[model samples]
Target: MKDIFSTIKIQVNEKIYVKDPETSALGRKIIQESILLMEEIGFDNFTFKKLGTKINSNESSIYRYFENKHKLLLYLSSWYWSWIEYKLFFATTNVDDSFEKLKKAITVVTEKIVDDKATAHINEAVLNKIIISEYTKTFHTKEVDEENKEGYFLIYKRVINRIVKLITEVNPEYPFAKSLASTIIEGSLHQHFLRDHLKTITNCDEHVSPTDFYINLIITVLKK
Candidate 1:
């Protein structure tokens, strides 16, 4: 009977031993530092040893938390989306008017993309790789089923629905506002990334700020 009791206690302790807040915090720190390193060195040149050195931990420690560099990159990508969501949430919370809220959202998002130091350091190749990898992971699968489509579409629809609601509040007569909103959101992202090269190709010396372009584009679309 005593042996049985001792075994139960040992099992409980083993389960609880895996849960450590300090270790979790340390892991998060390692992830953030890894992102900065990727930004500096570019993803191709980034290595586990460099990341481990930055975090003052062994490669084994990082592997214990994350399987590999690819997994770490995915986590960083997810973190970027979460960061954008938080910024948009905060920007919209206090605005009384829907149009104002929408304007704030556009402005905040453009400013974040354009001005983020870490984001600027990540070259186009790395960004494209990350985007393509994530897209394929979420959409492409061995079995294409309704559940997969529905799951992916849910995320897209939610974003479009939110934008459409804001647009409709400002201009009720706009036809196919939902589709237009989706186009604007996606277009702005593409435009931001391509702006620097587009200017050079066009030989336009004057600089154009992403925020101004986004604001103007939004106003033009809303008016139409």
Candidate 2:
């Protein structure tokens, strides 16, 4: 799997960028450093000028790849989901049992992410942190509806629907497969956020992980 993924390119929507960052050295540096910078600072404080400073390039050069920071965030979000979709596909592809496949799919999405050495330019661990902290900004805008029409979120929705299929396979009578699948994806992020920043509210800690909580919740909800 590692060998295969090393050769695979995680493609994002072309509309999200002026130029594909994966195509050139400077562009790849922009992506590599942006994740570190975004994780260090934040989306609000993040700017092209700062990214340019970090990468030792002109701000105009950064703009050659991304029109603005929001578009860059969209690009990053798209790439993250696309990667997760790949992991989800491989994790559950050959599992024969319906309930077990659903559990594996849940584990893939909800588990704490580790860095994958296959992709040298992009760090999955830092990118996962960025996704937890900054992913909402990608879509929580006035332009979200228009962007949705443009298929800006197709990969994200596809991830949700993949799990939705697993949910229905486990329990065909369950009418809220879509709702449950979406919640598992979105709610896992929320839980991770809470686990890190707002520890008083979330049960997930060093011992009880978000994956454990979601797996138990799924079993309780679906075992009926």
- Per-candidate TM-scores read 0.61, 0.99
lDDT of 1 by residue, 150-169 (tens): 34234344555667787898
- The candidate 2 region of ten consecutive residues with least summed lDDT is 4-13
Local accuracy of candidate 2 as per-residue lDDT tens digits, 85-156: 999999988899999999999999999999999999889999999999889898899999999999999999
Q: Local error of candidate 1 at 144, Å? A: 11
TM-score quality measure for candidate 1 = 0.61
Where does candidate 1 clash, by residue pair? Answer: none
The global C-alpha lDDT for each of the candidates, from Candidate 1 onward, is 0.55, 0.93
* Global Cα lDDT for candidate 2: 0.93
Q: After TM-score superposition, what is the CA distance of residue 18 in candidate 1 from its true location, in Å?
A: 12
